[model samples]
Target chain A: MFEYPALFAVAAVVREGSFERAAHVLNITPSAVSQRIRLLEERIGAVLIVRGQPCTPTEEGRKICRHVERVAMLEQELRAVMPSLGGEEALESRITLPIATNADSLATWFLDAAMGAAKRQGFLLDLSVEDQDHTATGLRRGEVLAAVTTLEKPIPGCDSTPLGSLRYRATASPEFLERYFADGVNARTLAQAPGIVFGKKDTLQYQWVRRAVGHDVAFPTHWLPSTHGYVEVSLGGMGWGMNPALLVGSLLEKGALVELIPGLCVDVPLFWQARRLSSALLDELSGAVVKAARASLLWTGAGR
Target chain B: MFEYPALFAVAAVVREGSFERAAHVLNITPSAVSQRIRLLEERIGAVLIVRGQPCTPTEEGRKICRHVERVAMLEQELRAVMPSLGGEEALESRITLPIATNADSLATWFLDAAMGAAKRQGFLLDLSVEDQDHTATGLRRGEVLAAVTTLEKPIPGCDSTPLGSLRYRATASPEFLERYFADGVNARTLAQAPGIVFGKKDTLQYQWVRRAVGHDVAFPTHWLPSTHGYVEVSLGGMGWGMNPALLVGSLLEKGALVELIPGLCVDVPLFWQARRLSSALLDELSGAVVKAARASLLWTGAGR
Candidate 1:
């Protein structure tokens, strides 16, 4: 593994797609890439690549490439920070930020923000989530150094910045709504009307009902149990549910579903709350989240 | 960190109270333990222990020992299961089991059960909380493989074994009881008195009050937001609260707190439910949990 020439040879083949292109990438003979890959597979006692026109990575090769890429990034980062550790007395500073986000955000925007922030500072993001509403509890426990929350009030030791409002529309299949709420949709009537919810304590529809018709009641629900699946079910007309505007915009345009009540949507105003301490990493991340929120949300700030 | 011959060297020293004893347990010379400690400190660049006749792990040492013990246990279990795997196959079986549990159990029996199970089999436990009533929702997401819950009914596609009742008592600090209920406390007066709750959805005290008073009404509260802290506040005369029998036994016997309603206890039958699967690892773990539960809980079946 420590043989740099051998490791680089295999990496070049993987990057360049084929033995011919690998030679170009490495500025070496094609035979070198082929020979190196052969030696690596023999040493490891496993096939690393599936020989084909385009050349595909085997499961083993994918693992190796992942490890290689991580090692490369870590080494580069270490080298970049090595100069700052010149003095023994220097304080080693690392800021930890915590964010509570849904699964979709975790698989996408969260990583983007982390990469964007890491360019300027050495930081760790401690992300944990129960749901959108309860994400602030991590901040209260001091488990996270910062958080993105739906709560307006700041957790005791943190400062709050309004990121933006997440707009949600009450949508359902026309067939399902017609079957369930045929007697004209009202709060008392919709109490028995079947609906789908993201999770327990997720009250987007309840809040919508309260605003449209003054009442506080547990909406009858089939807990679909995920951000993605809830939208899928609502599209499937299993029940009426709150769909994030971004996900449903195209669907609404296509007349796949009808909004239960137009302009009676709920705006969950998200905030970035960080510890009172002045932290450069937290500031950088806060900026990125605010930018993302602005681009994604309607920004009416009705809830705020 | 690598300089230490093995993990848990400091833990052995602390548990045994001497370097010689620790060395005997580890099958190494005392001088080797001392040298390892010195080298470990040098590597981490922090003082880990206070040198004394008896042993004590420093705050930093405790953290490292904890991390070392977890990793060591994981490594041992991994090797035990996949002894002859090539590097590729060795990484395949790492699975994380999510669980929902209340704070008291999390700090006590749950951690012990998880660690013991992990020692017997290689797996990771990720824990979250939803109080006693709502733990079932965790199962709906396929988030947790199993949970310790008050709900007796099994979630769909899961099996539940009754772990016995967790009895809770309505108690107050002697002073607070005297102050709030001066009419020599009876059922009716207790309901109207201010109460302390674990959270918004925690209905233990409310149910007890309803049984006592025959009506529902809001009582003032101070949310300490921790299970142990809530019990402590109740004992300190903050307000009337429901205390778990497992948690408050010592305090009751020591005369630090009083049970306001003797024989008027809420018996919540807890259950251990897991997905019905043919996996050997989950089978062993669920069985171990039942065994541990028998030893620690109020068992009510088979042996009864």
Candidate 2:
């Protein structure tokens, strides 16, 4: 049988990213934390933690950390049913739910759901931000409990629910449109104009271009990774980029920003995927996320 | 002699993160791109690119990529002087400068400098956001040409210029302060009250708390990784956090947010670090960054 105490130590180390910080959180000595990890490693016959300036978990450690997190969630649920099991200290011990999400969602609508979950359940959140297309990798690696992703299908041992599409417009300032697309936005013009990309992982601009022009076009790009920076740079006529509709609504109305191609939008469908664990807290979080997403995102054929 | 074309191919593959994408950017066939990479690897006697969904550079590959980037900058300068050497196509070829910076700096002051550099020199910026304390890692690894960092000392081959301090105040909504610190602000109260942290790597809140309380205190934290989210959450009465003065100045003046302790502020001194390359473009970028930082950040006792 696995040692629950040692498992907790492993989880704390990974979460805090250091033995000393984990010790402080666990209310134990650093040496004691090291000994517990050593004992756990001997039993498992593998090096779980890679000690460094900020310690990191190996693949084996990540699996163990995931197990401990689920166990903690279950324990919290049990204590809720029987208050006499642990008392006030147990209630005050906050559980952190590590989740992965895209930056645009966090900037627009995800925080309301997160704040609601935290207030309702007294849960702390450890959010990992990644590109929407790549957020599923965290779930696959057992690094995050839940994720906002672009994958319609669920990974094995996980549940997937459809969150509506986040609409994006190929937006540019009036000056930018006039300066670059004066001759019109075709393959020739696009190849010469500068575009804004979120990062190397982001393909939103490429995807939108392929849809608009019917083929890939090589263009010069300024890679600015901030979501808000995208809007600001576009407004400054730095480059044309795919800006989220929700963020650019007022600008578009004010005529500060214009669509490179009017009436053409990209609707990227998102999903909330979480482990299929029978815990009320996880279900509550999933419910809050789905509710927020449904309220803000566009639903096809059924609603505007 | 080293092959310049093959080196450019290595840099492109790493920048684009896929051989096919590199080929598209270089206007070459995929097989031709592959051939260049293989020949470079054979000559170097080490693996350069790790083939995957998105290709990455090995350690040896990073060194070579850095070399190619510097060469590109120098070549651009040479063509600038001798206009007849390459002419329109050369002037049109936009060179990307990969830079590392903290999110707070990027959100506040860095974008202006980035936009300025891009406009003046026809450069493209590839920005990587990391914690201020850790931004220097990219410079040390030769992954980025420049970085905004908290380290006062320069990295071995880099030049560091003081960019003034980004002052932060421990702030919360009036309701939050009343609810959590009804009696007073001390280690005892701080240990029970929740805090907002940017991420696991963020230690700003901890540093502020240690200064306020005179010792380490264990507290629950909501790890929201967005700079704008920090202000929103603090305004929503979610938790107290170390917020940049620039963001919360109006809120403080309007009585929406209050400092935990009125006069205690943490001043994180920032510096601009870049490779000590003799390129005019690098110098122009540095001048722009230093100018922006001076205009926005605090300069300690000498200025308000």
lDDT of candidates 1 onward, in order: 0.62, 0.87
- Of the candidates shown, which would achieve the greatest TM-score relative to the real structure? 2
Query: In order, what fnat does every candidate score?
Result: 0.00, 0.60
lDDT of 2 at A277: 88
lDDT (tens digit, per residue) of candidate 1 on B1-304: 3543534667556434467756754657889888888787887788877776456668777666545444444554566678774332221234334556665555345556655674445454445566777788767655566788877777897899877766788888777777778786555465345566665446676578677666543343433334554565677565678887787888888877787767688867778888776556677778887777777767667542
Q: Write the per-residue lDDT of candidate 1 for residues A1-304, one digit (tens) a residue.
A: 3665566555445543466645653556778878888898898899887775446567677656544433443443454569563322111122223345554343323435543564345443334444677777656755455676777688887888887767788898777678777787785567556566655446676678778788643343444344544565676565688888777778888888788877778877777777665544556777887787677765765555
Worst 10 residues of 1 chain A by lDDT: A87-96
DockQ of every candidate structure: 0.01, 0.63
Model 1 spans with C-alpha error above 4 angstroms: A1-304, B1-93, B186-188, B302-304
Residue A61 in candidate 2, Cα distance off native in Å: 1.4
Scored on chain A only, each candidate's TM-score is 0.63, 0.96
lDDT of 2 by residue, A1-304 (tens): 6798789888888887788878888888999999999998998899999998568889899889999888888878888889687833421367888899999998888988888888788888888899999999999888898999999788998999998999999999999899889999898889878899898788888888899899988788788888998888999888999999999999999999999999899989999999888978889999999999999998763532
Query: Which has the greatest lDDT?
Result: 2
Highest DockQ against the true fold, candidate: 2
**Where is model 2 chain A poorest over a 10-residue stretch in terms of lDDT?**
A85-94
After TM-score superposition, the amount by which residue B120's alpha carbon in candidate 1 deviates from its true location, in angstroms, is 3.0
